[model samples]
Target: MPGERTKYAWRSHILAERALVGAAEHAREAAELATAIEPLAGADDVVCAYVPIRGEPGDLRMLDALCVRNATVLLPVTGEPGPLSWARYEGPDSLRKARFGLLEPTTATLPPDTVATATTVLVPALAVDLRGVRLGRGAGYYDRTLGAVGDGTRLIAVVRDNELVDRLPEEPHDRRMGWAVTPGGGLRELGHELPVSPE
Candidate 1:
């Protein structure tokens, strides 16, 4: 139970810390993050992003911002316990309740490999250390999805300002993120020891 214990311990600690974030403050931070990420979207570019659920840092406003920038935003469609399938984000009107209390696009689903076409991938994280080791929810969905991205893709971890930490528990199969975007800090490049390899 060591792995489970470690994972839960970190999860519990961070979630409790996040509980202090008031709804108003959360919305403000989410707005800041939306502004920060807008510049990352390019016209005619495909970007992979997620819709934030309750208690998550950024909200759907970020995705809407990407859409306004003319980027083809891809949202994850949960499936079997492997890499996540993607769906193009049509708009807020196109979202529906999905498994695990997630809001997913009702648009046609794309194959899991569709992530390869993304130029930037914004991932959800509880915390991301300076080394770019992202501490995710124990489900491992982002871990699997990120592993399949093209070598040139920019993997960015989205966390609250204080969630950018000095360190976190890591394993061999763990994938490192290249950047951490915080509500206050904007986009920060991490000094991870191991660079992400497409192999």
Candidate 2:
């Protein structure tokens, strides 16, 4: 319960910071994030990725890049709070507004276990620490859904360059990210030491 309070405080602080990002800056970062994500795209890769909402670091360009490379992309379909179901991403036209202001695919839904098929899963995060701890929006969607990922699946947290911090609070139910991709930093492995400027 103590950690929950800390987690909520962290979420509030990070979200307030995200809210101040200007449109031009956000667009530039989105473009850079797309470039960082492009290298991971492959024709045979099945990627589980999310659409950016609020002031999240990435945009549709990231998904478009993966599609351009012919990778099969799956987006999360919201339902009752539990493991997230999925749906195939056919392109921009295939998406429709869903619960929580999320853009979900309109295609046939896939079971929660479908995430096991992904080669990589890019998740949205408010911040990620050197130890791979990811800070979400206090919703347990990712924490619950990620449990279904198969071994060897790359669990990557997508955040802005500055959002990568030196440390974050970790709860027992929190799944650790193996990697993080930032607009300016590209992709970096987690659970290792990285020089971080003092806050």
Candidate 3:
């Protein structure tokens, strides 16, 4: 369980760092992320995304950008510790305060398997390494949920530029991200050509 312990330490370090980010810098990065995420999907695509909470990267504007492209966007609806259910994100008005201090869409919920319908999923992460290994909060929601996605679906982690690292502790059940989008980096492919190594 050393990897799990390392993961927790990484989470603490990253969250502490995020907590110290200045409001001006956070806003600038959020605006940049909004622009970066704007063209990610189009009218034909169904995107599974999240509304950032705490010091997570991006903001409501990022989700709005996806809507502006006419993409059908789905947001996670949390329940018990298992795969996440989903709901359509209509707009800011459609969100209601939900469990875990999250703002979830008020729309009717869909099954966890609904994520399979998405062309892209914007996963929230504390950090993502060059090998596509993502460091998430200890919850296993995404680990369980991402398995439902069909092959070739883009599992893209959303993080700040510095949050993208060279390596991270990867667990056996951990699903790898195919791409990462940062405020400054836009989008970059991961793990494709890198030599695998133990962290």
> Each candidate's TM vs. the true structure?
0.92, 0.93, 0.94
Per-residue lDDT of candidate 3, residues 1-199 (tens digit): 1335588788988999999998889989999999998998999999999999998988999999999999999999999999999999999999999999999999999999999999999999999988899999989999999999987799999999988888888889999999999999999999854566798
Weakest ten-residue segment in model 2 by summed lDDT:
1-10
- Residue 85 lDDT (model 1): 97
| TM-score computed on alpha carbons, candidate 3 | 0.94
Pairs with steric clashes in candidate 2? none
Best by lDDT: 3
Clashing pairs in 1: none
State the lDDT at 63 in candidate 1: 95
> CA lDDT of each candidate?
0.89, 0.91, 0.93
lDDT of 1: 0.89
Candidate 1 Cα errors over 4 Å, as ranges: 1-5, 192-199
- Write one digit per residue (lDDT tens) for candidate 1, span 124-146: 89988888888898888877877
Tell me the tens digit of each residue's lDDT in model 2 across 26-124: 999999999999889699999999999999988999999999999999999999999999999999999999989999999999999999999999999
